[model samples]
Target: MALAFGLAWVLFSIWMSLPWLTDLGNLAHPLIALFVLTFIAYVPGFMNAFLLISLVLRPSSRRETPAQWPSITILIAAYQEEKLIGETLRSIAALEYPGKLEILVLDDGSRDGTAARTRDCQALFSALPNMELKLVREEHNRGKARVLNHGLELASHELIITIDADTRLEKGCITSLVEHLVASPPETVAIAGAVLVANHDESWITRVQQWDYFHGIAAVKRMQGMYYGTLVAQGAFSIYRKQAVIDAGGWPDTVGEDIVLTWSLLRQGLIVRHAEDAIAWTHAPETFTGLAKQRKRWARGMIEALAIHKPLLSMRKMRTMFIWWNLLFVSIDLTFTFAFLPGLVLAFLGIFWLAGPITLLVLPLAALWNLVIYRIQTRMLKRMGVKMEKSLSGFLLYAFIYPLLMQPVSVWGYFAELFGGKKQWN
Candidate 1:
């Protein structure tokens, strides 16, 4: 980690010393130039360089399977998910884990027949050996965090796994998570599973998100996990030490419950991991409005976590670097929205105010970084017996058009949380 950081700083220093960049600083107002060059070239450039170096230099470790599989309780928080709850339970039943397993469907007062569907599936899955399926119904709509806390209170095993109602685990998902978390040091308390878009074929929006998931999201998680503390052990599909979660005070009541909970664990000096092979398929939002809402909430969640876990910055741990690095994301997003996008439009209109020669210098590095991430992710998927489809359109959109929409929406989310916007759990 030190080597990676050192190399990144050296390269950044070299870039800053370039004559044309210095000339730009002299030509423009200091504040405007600093904002343009820092966010556009400096911060993101350093981050990408660090991630690339760390990834290329990451050491490989042999994965050892556990001799005995520990019992696990699966928690699914459902609200108006009648159409998907049955399939989600069926997917859990199909898992290859041999250990005693318990499944809890926490129905958070769904207006639909979610509970009925769960109960019907419960009867069908009852014949499975060494498995118990139960439904816990709430009379009124409690949010996801509270529902998961209730499930935590009733969880029957030491290991707890949380999956969203729209999530479907691969056959080997549970085994992979168990193997990774158990092989980790005793302090390792949670492992986030790799989540991919299941409905990429539904629309162009989902298709672009598929690339985001398969490439960008996976790369970020792998980079963070390399240092032994993944920031967000996503509730979409993750495994946690039940006792560790209890020690962390269960999930917090926030839009980004998963983010806050994971940060809380980190704040307590516990290690969280990511299992790249533990794959889960989740439904992505098919419409633009849905995607914006989802990304906004995610952005808001990051802000909330950072605000709540401010003391984590003072922690003397290797993973604490990631906590500090997260502070740059909102600034990067804001600059991209308020500065870069408009500059892009101006450049196309034959004005080179913000999007000129210096800005274009970042593209080659960005392309190389994406290429590296894509190859690594594809190799991972290939090993899992998953085939990549040839989707030129999706890749192009994800590369060029996705950011134009994503950054602005994320800025909205940051401001929304700052101003106490209405919090709704989709």
Candidate 2:
């Protein structure tokens, strides 16, 4: 077939054009090395652009009619969330599209008054008709995977939404997410909620993360949601079609249960969509230590999630490709994290000057690319009608500083998870 020959030719051409690794990494010209590295690295990004364009053109499942409201259960796993759970319960009681809803809160051995607060909320929402609240408690601490596995079994509704205790739902969030699931084909198994950092103004660390979530995750989810195989349907605010969860073997006991669940659903050839309109506000870590711990847990969990799923065997091309993209970059990301900038700085100190004017273009060109990425994210957020913070400082950090910061943290996470260190969640 002409198609097979064309593919072979393209592969051969690319292989022939690639420079030897040792020569490419330590070139005579510092700038040329940087440029060459950048070019080869972004080859994947360019290939992924086709996938992004496909999703952006048709962000939804293309259904326009009203979907019938279904009976649903919202599940929340709580620890020391006493400060936030009351408001979370109130937000659920305040749902505008209250058809038939049951709320289940699992108090996973919190030493604090998290259990008592839920009881108070139970009394508060007692009069809210068609809304049921079931509170469960564990005498001691167990991991999130265990808590959620139990919650999924306890839930009696056809549709289930998993929420974090600290998340506050916007008025239309529940309605929008459920409707997106309802409108989707029966094979469309889960929906991811757009998570915005509510505590962005609480501290400098939170402020930095605010833009990262808004500008980074918001756009990434929209693109990934295209074929309904977004990597992670976050536990913070995710809706699922129940039978699909049962079919996918419930939530697994991995550091990253949410992502593993998403992968499992995809492996089974079910869809996991992103409902950008279904908004949820959750608190971010307000300190560097806090943020690092959170990221480390997430990173370690992600590695574990990837290991457990080992998705290449799946017959679905799109799902396999998505997993492959994430898996493909472990060594590359670590290389850039440790070597790239440090090498450039050391080269300058060692009097390794640029060979020509061409090498001087890397920094400015990279800065421009960052700016473009931020602007695209801003436009996406505006399209979704999410509010943007007016901090020029945050915007600048988002464009330049955040990428460097994330790399080291991810590296630390990989090591920590591998070595069995750092395992506490607040």
Candidate 3:
């Protein structure tokens, strides 16, 4: 961490000394130029540089397996997931685990046939002597956090895992999660798994999202895990020590329940790690509206976490830096949406003010960051026997256009949370 910090500062020093940046500062209001340069360029560049250095310097080590795997309860949170619930259940049924497993489908008052379909799949998939499948029905529409708390009460084992109803696990995913969780340091109470896009071929939106998941989200989690605190034990697929979660007050009722829960655990100084080999494939939203809604919910969730866990800002730990890093995302998103984007339009119309040649200096770092992360993630996928999707168009859109759409949407979400927008679970 010290090395990474030094490396980041060194790069920042070089970036600050650029003559064009000085000129830009002179050309505009110094504060405005600093805002654009600091949030828009330096913070992101520093983070990427830190992640790259840490990954290269302290790569993940291979661990030996435990003598015996612990029994675990798997919770599937469902809400109008009739179409995808069966396949998800079957994937859990086919898991390659040695320990006794209990599968609970928490139906959160779905009007659809989710419960019936779970029952049908249960009959076919629960024949294994070591595993049992059951459905817990909530007649009223409670949110995911409440339903998960309900599942926690019925879990028979100390180890617990939460997976989304729309998520499908690879055959060895459970094994991988259990292995890593058991092998982690004693302070580690949770292990987040890798989630890939299953519907990347469905649309351009999904395609771009695939790259986002593969390059951005996964790489960030991997880096965070290296520091012994994976920020979000994402509900899509993650394992937890049951008592640890219970002590953390269970999942919170919020737009970003998972992130809040994770932060709660972190507040207690407990550690969380990420398991890249534990892979779960999920369906990305295929439409522009769907994508926007998802991103907005995510943005709102970050704000919720920041507001809820303000104490994290006072911690001096290496992992807490991620929380501080997230605080800057607000400014970064704001500048990109309101300043740099409009600057681009103006520059195209023959004005060079907010964004110009100086802005382009950040691109090489961004591109290199993407390349390094892609290589690391693809290597992990290959180790798991999954092939990388060959999509040039997806890469192009993700590299250029995806941010343009997402930053504005995230800004809208930030405002929505500030002004009391309605929250949805699905």
Off by over 4 Å in 3: 1-28
Give the alpha carbon lDDT tens digit for every residue of 254-350 in model 2.
7777888888888777788888778889988888888877887778877887777775445656556667656655654576566555655666676
- Cα lDDT for residue 290, candidate 1: 98
lDDT of 2: 0.72
Q: Model 1 over residues 1-426: C-alpha lDDT tens digits?
A: 645664665476447545645555777775677776678777776777777777777666335687888999999999999988888888888888889899999999999999888888876677888789999999999899999999999999999999999998898889889988878888899999999998889999999999999888998899889889899999999999999999999999999999999999988888999998899999999999999999999999999999998999889887887887788888888889887888889989987666666666567666877888888888888898866574678889999999889999999999999999999786
TM-score of each: 0.95, 0.84, 0.95
| TM-score of candidate 3 relative to the true fold | 0.95
Model 1 scores a C-alpha lDDT of 0.86
lDDT of predicted model 3: 0.86
1 against 2, candidate with superior TM-score: 1
Better of 1 and 2 by lDDT: 1
Cα deviation at 95, candidate 2, in Å, is: 1.6
Q: Residue 425 CA error for candidate 1 (Å)?
A: 1.4
Q: RMSD to native for every prediction? A: 1.9, 4.9, 1.8
Which stretches of model 2 miss by more than 4 angstroms?
1-40, 43-67, 313-316, 347-388, 422-425
Give the Cα lDDT of each candidate: 0.86, 0.72, 0.86
